[model samples]
Target: MPAFAIAAEDPATPDIAALIGQHLAEMHACSPACKVHAMPAARLAQTDVTFYAARVDGALAAVGALKALDATAGEIKSMRAADEWRGTGAGPAILAHILREARARGYRWVGLETGRHPVFGPAQRLYAAHGFRECAPFAGYVSDDFSLCMGLPLA
Candidate 1:
């Protein structure tokens, strides 16, 4: 497979929307709670925020977003990699790229909420490997059995 490139762009872009659709589909396919807990795709696509995607051979392989929560903090949202691309380092690559962009934009800390179920083990491992540690919920999210909160300092 070709090397992947992560690009920072508007999620409103058509290509980005397609990638988001694929991401949401994969997440929902893996776990129904993804759709239950996730913000609607249409709403996410319309948000004005920093969005990133990993592209391989000009096709989107993974996508994520960093929404500014405050001057010093940002929230990781809509993180997903295509099923075929999972376990290929694409998710971590996309995450690292998102963090770099977050730091460049002046965020001191990045936070994220992901599913806590056994089905999400790989995702949890990916976040851990990238230096994200468990943390209390940030933003307006409530603690829930189906969710886990994680954070990392921007270097």
Candidate 2:
């Protein structure tokens, strides 16, 4: 297994964009009917947010984002780990990094939306294991049977 490094970068960076594209492709390929909608790479690259990518031996292994919602709030978005690296702790490490970054940026709360499908079970567990608790939807999202919302308070 390759060692991984997680860090932030501009979404527009060529390598970052490619990594995001690859991550999105892997997610879609794994779950074509994914309850959580996959944002197009172009749209993701245009967002004003902190994006982190996991690199193994200088190759992208995963990518995720922390979007600032307000002075004390942030939202997790587009988290994806390469299929080859899924069971190698890449996901959790990337998530932990995002949480740390959120706290560092003065965010009092961080939340995420994910599918409630079986394929998402691991992700839900990952979040729960990291101290995130199930919560009502935020950021204009309405209740949906196929979706789950989770949050963690930093304070």
**How many collisions per candidate?**
0, 0
For candidate 2, the clash count comes to 0
Over 1-155, each residue of candidate 1 has an lDDT whose tens digit, in order, gives: 45888877667677777667665665677555533455544566555566777888877778887778888888888888877787787888888888887888898899888886687798889999989999987776655776788999886
lDDT tens digits, residues 30-138, model 2?
Answer: 5545454555556665555777888888776778888889989999888888777788888888898998899898999999988765777888999999999989989
Top candidate when judged by lDDT against the true structure: 2
TM-score of each: 0.82, 0.83
Return the lDDT, model 2, position 147: 73
State, as a TM-score between 0 and 1, how close model 1 is to the true structure.
0.82
TM-score of 2: 0.83
Cα-based lDDT for every prediction: 0.76, 0.79
Give the worst 10-residue stretch by lDDT in candidate 2: 30-39
